[model samples]
Target: MPTPVIDIDSLTKVYPRQIGQPARRSLDDLRLRIGENEIFGFLGQNGAGKTTTIKILCSLLRPTKGAASVCGHDVRTRAARSCIGYLPENPYFYEYLTPRETIDFYGRLQGLDKATRAREWDALSERLDLRGIGAQRIRGFSKGMRQRLGFAVALVGDPPVLILDEPMSGLDPLGRRMIRELILSLRAAGKTIFFSSHVLGDVEQICDRVGILVEGRLRTQGRIDELLNRRNEQVELVVSGLSAETADALARDALHARRSEAGLHLTTADAAAANAMARAALSEGGQIVEFTPIRESLEAYFVKEQAS
Candidate 1:
């Protein structure tokens, strides 16, 4: 097994009571590990301690108990912080600073001199598609632009590990794809990523392993490889022009069936069964409207974990 790039052992955090509000446990003995060069997706619902855990990892918030380390260094130490590039749930910047100035400012904070900072900006600007807006003030930029710049800032020192909280929140579809591809390319260049997102589909596409946080505690942790390989595959067949009687007959061979304006929605165990049903429906003057293979997905697994 590879050494863990980021490790949390029995990490817990609690908020002290406030005026008219009760103290709450934001993280409850959560334990997790992300291997080097791996994409680890942190999945959770709102108020699920995801942000709490992330804050602790970034050393922005202290844990009430337990410990977390980054690249073998204590999270509270400067060494650990140096190895990580952190982007918060909402990345905010001075409205007047252009992308060029913003990147330079963060680079300076990372201890980079002007010469080195300019070099890094050259590569990042082109890669993140920020060339056009490089001189534009951040004030008039849209959410997508801000998001891209936030990611660029996080890459300032080219840290080996990235900890992003909801990095894709305000991005449109194209913007999301750009970020996703950039993340993949980063991993290809040997950076380990630890990101928390409600976007399960993106997690399913890129993560090698995933850990789900529920109610401030990690409920499950496992690899995504072969996560759905053993589960049964269901194919949905929608047939139009089928009479009520024919639809009922088709349902006999389907695991389940329903009639809708689109047509009869029939689900079968596999593609073979679906094909057979489609043939039957066509023989009865019905046309095939849709044939879709439905597999066990990360969303389904996530839902199960939540219910459990």
Candidate 2:
């Protein structure tokens, strides 16, 4: 197996009691291992401690207990931090600074000299499609433009890992497409990405593996195909020309079936039973419109996980 680029071993973060109330356990025994060059999706609804996890990983927030390591370096050590880059959901860049100037400012903080920052900024500007807007103040840039600029800033020193929080938030379709392409390109360049977003569709499309966080805990984590394969217990049966009485009988026989426009929609836990029901319908006066197994989708799996 490949070495993990990021590893969280029983990482826990707690907020001490404020005012007069009890302390808050923001993260309880969170554990995850993100492999090298993999796009790991961090999925969760609002108030699910997704941000807290990211902050702790980025070393912005100290963990109350446990440990997290990035790129084989402990997060507690200062040397481990230089290899990571973070892009917040809303990146606040100076309005007076141009894209080039914005990147240069960040680069200076990274200890890059003016000549090095200029050279690096020039290359990144072209790579990120910020050519024409190099001289324009960031205040006039659109949301997509700002996002791209923020990404360029994050890549100034070529960090091995990226921690992005809602990188696609507030982006239009074209902007989303651009970011998706950029993410794929980064993966190709051997950069491990740990991104959190509410956009499940984007995660499904790009991530090799996804970890679901609900109620401040990671409920599940695995390859997308593996998860879907594990939840493959759905069957659908379509029957037509059934009388109201026959439909009621069929519904009672099946586990969960409803009447659709084409015919009766039947969803059974047992595939063999679903097939038997279809055969019975065909043998009787009822017509079998269709009988196909319904594959579980990512969204359905999330809902089921939450329900359980």
Candidate 3:
């Protein structure tokens, strides 16, 4: 196993009771271990405590109970802070400052010298497509523009880990793609990434592992294929040389069946049923054309869990 870089153990956060309300727990014994250079996707519906967990990891909020650490250092310490580059759900900026000024400002805060800051700006501006708008004030920039600049700001310190909350919130398709690819490249460059997003499709595309948070608790966490394998997998068996009547007979127990120009298509709840149908078709002098498994998608799983 790779060395653990981000660790959370029995992490719990409870909101204090208000005048008219009882105490509410935002995170309950949430535990997760993310290894070095891993892209861990945090998934949850709205108000599921995803942000609360992220805030605790970023040291923006104290967990009512339990602990969280970055690179083996407590989140409350300077060492842990130094290991992370954070991008909040809504990235705020000095409206009067240009992208160039903003990038340099953050670099300075991270203790970079003039020469180093300039080099950092050059690389980030080019990568984030901020070069053209470098001199333009951010006050009038679009949401996507600010998001790109915010990501550039996060990289100002070249931290070893990135903790992003809704990093793709305001980006267009191209911008989202850019950010997604940038994240993958960052992991390739040895950065550990932990992010929470409602964009299940994007997470499904890039994340090595994912944790689903539902109502302040982690329902599950594991590799995409492994997690999905626990659920029933649908299989489609296609066969040729079978008449409509024969196809109907063979696929009588199938979830759905159809005979098209392509072939006789039999969709079953599991591979075993598909195999049975294929055997029946083959025994009837039919030629097996294909068997395809349609795995449960992250979005489907996420929706079901949230509703559950």
The sequence of per-residue lDDT tens digits that candidate 2 reaches over residues 165-251 is 999999998888888888999999999999998777888889999999888789999998898884556688889987888788889
lDDT of 1 by residue, 1-308 (tens): 57799999999899999999999999999989899999999999999999899999999999999999999999999999999999887799999999999999999989999999999899889888899999999997888888889899999999999999998887788988888998999999999999999888999999999999999888888887566653457899999997878888899889998888898899999888999999999999999999998878899899988999
Q: Which stretches of candidate 3 lie over 4 Å from their true place?
A: 19-22, 230-232, 239-241, 253-255, 259-263, 269-291
Considering every candidate listed, which one attains the maximal TM-score?
Answer: 3
The parts of candidate 1 lying over 4 Å away from their true place are 225-230, 237-251, 257-266, 270-291
Full-model lDDT, candidate 1: 0.91
- What TM-score would you give candidate 1 relative to the actual structure? 0.85
Q: Which of 2 and 3 is the better model by TM-score?
A: 3
Which runs of model 2 end up more than 4 angstroms from their true locations? 20-22, 230-293
TM-score of 2: 0.81
Q: What ranking of all candidate models by lDDT puts the best one first?
A: 1, 3, 2
Please rank every candidate by TM-score, starting with the best.
3, 1, 2
Clash pairs (backbone) in predicted model 2? none
Candidate 3: which pairs clash? none
Give the per-residue lDDT digits (tens) of candidate 3, residues 92-120: 99999999999999888888899999999
RMSD of 3: 2.5
